[model samples]
Target: MSDLQVGLISLGVVLILVVLVFNWWQDRRMRGRMREHFPETDRDPLMGDVTPAPGRREPGLHLAPASGDLPAEDAVDVDPNCEAVIDVTFAQPVPSDRLHAATQALRAVGSKAVRLFAKNDNGDHRAILREGESYASVQLAVLLANRSGPLTDIEWSQLWTMAQNLAERFDGSVEGPEQARVMARASQLDALCAGLDAQVGLALRLGGTRPVADVTRQVKDAGFMLHDGQLAWLSEAGMPRFVLLYDGVQVRDVQSDGVDRIDLLLDVPNSPADSQAFSRMASVGRDLA
Candidate 1:
């Protein structure tokens, strides 16, 4: 090999080594800075005392409490008929603060909502866990069905796993209905929802394409406000009673060219029941026409 060629190869190798060493040193320095900023501690600032207290009684579980069993102020909005519930009893009464901190990450499993209720010494279940109070048991309720659809096996498993983990953490025991029963209930609930789910829409077609901005201005003037990219007609409670779409797309997505048609939709399940929903929609449709 030529001496010049060997020297050039040696230079390239040395440069590569230098780059690697520099990167390693930079990473180490950044890690040191992070450690200084966040020093390791035996007790967590959020959740203190990882160990369970001594002389805790054995955990147990039971069926969900009836609505009448809970006080009005502490009642949760969960429906026992349409929810998969798990009862968890701790080996010892756990502080509300610790329970709240532990459950911060367990609000939902996929599309299904999970609700927690704590039980006090009086056997009263409360949705809001009060600070400084200790709870003997808790109920975890997962909604079986919603607009998204029925809870699947994966979601059920996730709930079970989460419950099991929570039980282990608090030296507790969890009991819930069989997976098959939960799945069957979820299916029935979904079918019932499917029968009642309804959406009414009216289309306004123009003689020719018109500027989207002009149409939006007219809509806004007529008391429709932009919400989440779509134009919505809200009720007095600030809830959307109807939504407007431009050419099957969100009103905010229309740009450059005008639209030939606009669709007004009323989601029946979401609208207020006493608002004369259909009658009001028909009246609006006539006016728009």
Candidate 2:
């Protein structure tokens, strides 16, 4: 054989050996890490006994415990009656009384996922409450927290916890924590009666009489760009109609009877708007309805 040919063969042999050694070393490192985090799972068939898949990059992928293993924190002693603290707040005099009374009313109505708390602040009545798990819930919390009445720390804590839990549960999924709370608050408004003693008007306004506003607020709060306007009937037989707008466009019209049903009228164009007239019409319809 020629001297040049022999030299080329030697170089090829050395390169192949280097690749083999590097792959072996990498496999060993991955297997070591996987073994530290997981004990019961089977090893990948193609990889070494302790190694994960070659290209896996998911965060905490190797850190998962056995599928059914409870978190270690569960082993610690805990109060059976202890509830998760959600939020805290302070409320003023008349609102505090109203909140306390409203809480009693909510209990009487057998409301689920609703709570109310009240306290005296140096002779001023104060209160706080939590409604549910969506946007309506936080809106209610905000309204309660922002009202003219005195509020207490306890109420604020409950509301905050409720919001945080909802966010954690449904944050990235459709209809997240903000939406859940908002929906709940809207339902509460649907249940409100005409002759209710307190400022029912303001509550209805702040809580929103229709789902479109609640949904719109939630979409905005979730960092989504608004695209459509909505108006709807919040009452059965269209007794109480409401309108909702987004980005200067009408999206829905809602009407409902004080009974069991509400209807939503949506304004979706077949194509994007061209003239300003269509935009104006949608806006006017939303405001007027």
Candidate 3:
């Protein structure tokens, strides 16, 4: 072959080898990250061609690097000691004037982990009404763990619902038909959540992948009715169950049609203690009143 022809052939071979090396390195890095985060799962990112996209960022908290430099068939171990614990207090029947007070109160305990609790009109703590802080943490962990791009609404909704359903289906130590009752109540709660006013200032505080805290400081600021007292605590199927307080008296056995969004009441046991508890957060009342 001529000298020019031989040089061209050599150049082509070098280019091919470079491309191959680059691809292999990228795959190794991607797999390393996934295994580090999900050590228990049997899935392999390399097998599925799951490449981390450009500019990937997780919401709420930063994720740690992959578990190790080697490719293992299993996931890495999670550091139990590193996990965070958030303490929340669900204070309710907050009026408008109490909004600032609640904020101030939340500020007093402000760490990234601590969340203040505010109640809805029915008087049951929203966090208690939903799943607990651990469930919320799992949700946060999922978000932080997912190093990919933004999840579509449907994607996020599906995951969120899955976590919730899983929590309901398996109630830790609780057993038997108790699982079914949880599902029914979740269905009912679903209907109630949809009717909540956007202005009510409802928000979730992300702890890991779960929303550990549900704050109603804004609802109190909006001047909605506030109640205190342990009304009714019913965990039945067919409707979203809540603690109910009526006429400043709490009752826990009332069930209502899934409509009327605004007037449906939660029946928790009522008392002067409930009233006093509700009034203490009066700053919320002032904002909404």
Residue 28 in candidate 3 has what lDDT?
78
Backbone clashes for every candidate come to: 0, 61, 59
lDDT of each: 0.75, 0.33, 0.30
Models, CA RMSD each: 25.5, 28.5, 31.6
lDDT of 1 by residue, 1-289 (tens): 9999999999999999999999779667655654454345444332344455478422222223344444445644457888888888899988777787777777778988887777865566767766556788887789999988999999989989988999999999999999999999999999998998788776767657889888888878877897776789888888887888888777767665798997888887777643355455545544454
Candidates in order, TM-scores: namely: 0.51, 0.16, 0.18
C-alpha lDDT of residue 278 in model 3: 26
Q: Which of candidates 1 and 2 is the stronger one according to lDDT?
A: 1
RMSD in Å for candidate 1, one decimal? Answer: 25.5
lDDT of 3 by residue, 167-222 (tens): 34333121122334333443444455445523111111122231111122333234
Runs of candidate 2 exceeding 4 Å displacement:
41-289
Model 2 CA lDDT for position 81:
28
| Ten residues in sequence with the least summed lDDT for candidate 3 | 138-147
Query: Which candidate's TM-score is highest?
Result: 1
